[model samples]
Structures are given as structure tokens and as C-alpha cells.
Target: MPPIAMPPGLKLAQDVMTPAEETELIALIEGSGLAYTPYDKGNTRSSTSYGWKYDYANDSFVPCKPIPEGFRTIAERAAAAAGLSCDDFAECLLNRYEPGAVIQPHLDKPVWEHVVGISLGVPTTMVFREPASGEERPVELSPRSLYVLADDARYVWQHSLPPMQGTRYSITFRTFSAEGLRRLEACPAEI
Candidate 1:
């Protein structure tokens, strides 16, 4: 297990969950949504290319859909450890990949109580670069692990997945707003 790294304002815990927990989460997300669209992806005003995001900002987002029993249990524990109530958090932004798929680097826009993610299935490299300086840190996201980015890290540094060279499963957990939820319901995320 890798010690949680607090680089500057960033807080990263590589192995937050057990292996069994990871397997259960993958099944939960993959089985939930039949048709899927691009998530957390975008291109900025500049020429730099970015990847998709699971924008819960829209109303079409299935907030209560993907919260598998096991996942919610884990979230509760992690929240307690962090001294949070968990009730205030938003829904899970689940992302599934076959192979050779990748998400680009970008900062998480503030929307929920915290920015959370869970990794399962085949291991993947999660690279974090200092949002401004470009210094990079690569961490292997293992099964059933919780990755929490809060406070400074959520807005300060940039994190992204390398090309999904091999098939892997991941469910990114995040929080959203009632207003944003209304928007998602009305228009839904284009990505």
C-alpha cells in the first residue's frame, strides 16, 4: 500500500479499499448503464486537448442509479475517517473502459462536497502533474482503492489517466449540486 501523498495542497491515497471491494464496484457500474457517452472530457480555449469527464452537473445523470450497496458502505467509512457526514456528498461519477482509452489532464471544477474516485479491475496508471509547474507523479490505481482529492488538491493540481492500454474498470465517485442536478435533468451533459 502506498502512503497517502500530500503534495502541496493535494491529498492522494493509493490504496483506500480492499481488493474484494474493488471487484464489487466494477460490476455495479458496468451493469448499471446500458448506453454511455463521453465523461469528464473537454477541449479548452487553447489548443491543448483534454479528456472526458463524468459531468454530474446535468440532470440526465443517474444519481441514485449507480450507488451499489457495497460502494455506499465504503463511502460511509471513508467519510467517517475524514470526519465528514457523507450525507452531503453527491452521486458517483462512474467511468468504465475497455482498453486503450484515456482521460486527459485537468482540474476538477467545484461542484460537490468532495472529489472521490474508486479503481477496480486491471490496474491503471493515474498520473498527477502539478497543475502549473507540470511536474508529474504516477500512481498505479489498484482494485477496490479509494482516491480522495479534496480541499487544495481538487482545485490545485491536475490529474488524468494515461491511455487505457489494456482493458480496465473504474468508477469515479463525485458530488454534484441541486442546481446542477436540475440542469443535468433538463439538458444533460453533451459529453
Candidate 2:
């Protein structure tokens, strides 16, 4: 991925919690397996709970975790980051990873609507870039931190957490209205 300057209204924030909070968060991810997944080492693929599929061999969004919080506070922040309020936000999925797990590089794919992500638990590095220009930038996200991707960031860029060796967590923020959910049978989301 190439490195393209972020557009206006974009904010990437890190370290949303204190060290004590980070420790507590690590306990949450390791214990919950929000990162719980089965990996095909030969193919480098894994699954969480979202029912989204991932084909690491091809670097595509196959399937993975669901938005765990159902689009709560963090969703609000993501919306805010996009210049929208909570009303414009929709769902959230928690990516929980334990030691020695790896997620391949791929974008969220267009099937879903909008997306937002926050890093939590142990720190992790996310790969990003200007999709059109092939510019790349790798960012390390800390526990309790928030990342809002919208506008050109939404359609023009690709992102992934790659592989990691320790406990790590990522909460993705997404948006779709109730009416919007009515349009998609699978999106009502049991809040």
C-alpha cells in the first residue's frame, strides 16, 4: 500500500486508556477469544464470529467476527470521526486475538456499508495505504484507541492488522440505519 496524506476531517487516535485499563483489556481479549479463531497455517486463514469469510491466500475478506458492542459508544466516536453523530453509525465488531495468531491483509470489502476501527488490549500494527496510488503506511494502534475511516479513506484505501504474536483487540465501528437494515435481511443485528 502507498502512503497518501489523510483527507480533511480524518483523525487517527491512540492510547484511549491507562496502563491499568490496557491490562484489564488484555484479560478480556485472551479470555473471550473475541479473537477466538481457527487458522489454516498452510493457507494463513482464520475465522472469528462475524460470519464474514477471509481468503488470506488471495488477500480477500472472506469472513470473520461480528460487531460485538452492536455499535455503542465507540460507534459514536467513529461516527464523530466521520463528522456524523451516533445517528449515522451502525454496528461494531470486536477482533480478539491471542498469542501466535495472524490476520492477513485485505479491505473490509464493499458488501458491508461504512466501517470504523479501534485498537485495544495489547498493541498491534495495521497496514494501510492509498489504494489507487499503492502508497503504504503502517500504524501501530494502542489499547483503547480509536480510528475513524471515512470519505476517500473508505473507498480508496485498504487496511489489515497482519499477524501478531500476543493478545490484541480491535473494535470495528460500522453504520446502517434501521430502515437500512430492513433492506438487508442479515443486518437487523440483535442489539
Candidate 3:
């Protein structure tokens, strides 16, 4: 397959999902019976994890439920669009951001190679910063759009979203590294 043309390590597709599709997906997430919790520390957003949950205290993945069917469908389509293998992703994190919620700047942990995010509800600006140059680039995330971060963007640049204007949600799909896969397998609980 030809590589998807993208900016260095980032791929973005706007209007990837229709409004109705976005609404349906959001409803599915809300009704999925997953445990959505606030960041144990200080974050304002709430999130639910599938396949693996990050244990902030231990800095590792703990067993979690399998990815929901609705999320799997979206992840598969986004992976195909980004020129990635659908099976590569084994986890999904669903985040719900209320108005005034903010995400701090941080690079995704090394356990996950690629980060694919599907934006729903409302639009927001996601800012990416180069660690070496300290330069910043802001991208507007339109509702029903998809963004993928890989390579340098995944490892070198840190991304964040400012306080939001309205309630918004994002579904992020992540692929585990070899070590991460082993960790998941070694866990006693089924994921």
C-alpha cells in the first residue's frame, strides 16, 4: 500500500463522519456501561478505556474490557485511511470534555506507537509543540474529523487542547508496542 501523504508524522481528515454518525457513536459510548472516570490527579475531562487502562501510579497498562463494536468500526476505518493495519490497534480511550476542559501538553507514552483520534460533538484547537525548537502549531479539530499521530509527531512533539467552548468528545485508538503486548498477555485478568 502507498504511504498516506501526511505532514511529517501527522495525518488529518476533516468531515470524516457525518453528524448523524457522530451522534450515534456518541450515544453508543454513553450507553456502553463502561466506567468513565475523571483523571485520578487533576484533569477535568472524564475517560473510559478499552483493552487496557493506564495505571497512573504504576505507569503501566492494566487489564480492561475489549474494544466496543462501535469503536472498533471507527478505528478500522481510520486506520485504513491512515495507511495503518486495522489489527495494530488494541485499545481505545474515549474522552468526554465539558466546556472549559483542558488537556495538558504531553507526548503519548512509548507503549503506544500510533494515536488515532476521532473528534465529535464540537470543534476545538489542538496545539502541537516541537520539543527541540519549542515551536508550536495549532490545528482546529472539526467535529466528525479524524487525526492520526505517528513517528516524530508521536514521539517528539507534545500535543494539547485548550479550554473548550462547548462539550466535546474524542475517541482515541492506540496500538501497543511488543513489550506492551507482553505486559497485557502476562496480566492475570482477561482484557
Clashes of each: 15, 24, 0
- Candidate 3 has which clashing residue pairs, if any? none
Looking at model 3, which ten-residue stretch has the lowest summed lDDT? 34-43
Worst 10 residues of 2 by lDDT: 43-52
| Runs with alpha carbons beyond 4 Å of true place in candidate 3 | 1-7, 33-42
- Report the C-alpha lDDT of model 1 over 151-171, residue by residue, as the tens digit: 656766788877675656655
TM, every model: 0.68, 0.63, 0.88
Candidate 3: Cα lDDT at 84: 83
Q: How would you encode candidate 2's per-residue C-alpha lDDT over 135-157 as one tens digit per residue?
A: 77676677678777666656666
> Which of 1 and 3 is the better model by lDDT?
3
TM-score ranking, high to low: 3, 1, 2
Report the Cα lDDT for candidate 1: 0.57
| Best-to-worst ranking by lDDT | 3, 1, 2
Best by lDDT: 3
lDDT of 2 at 166: 69
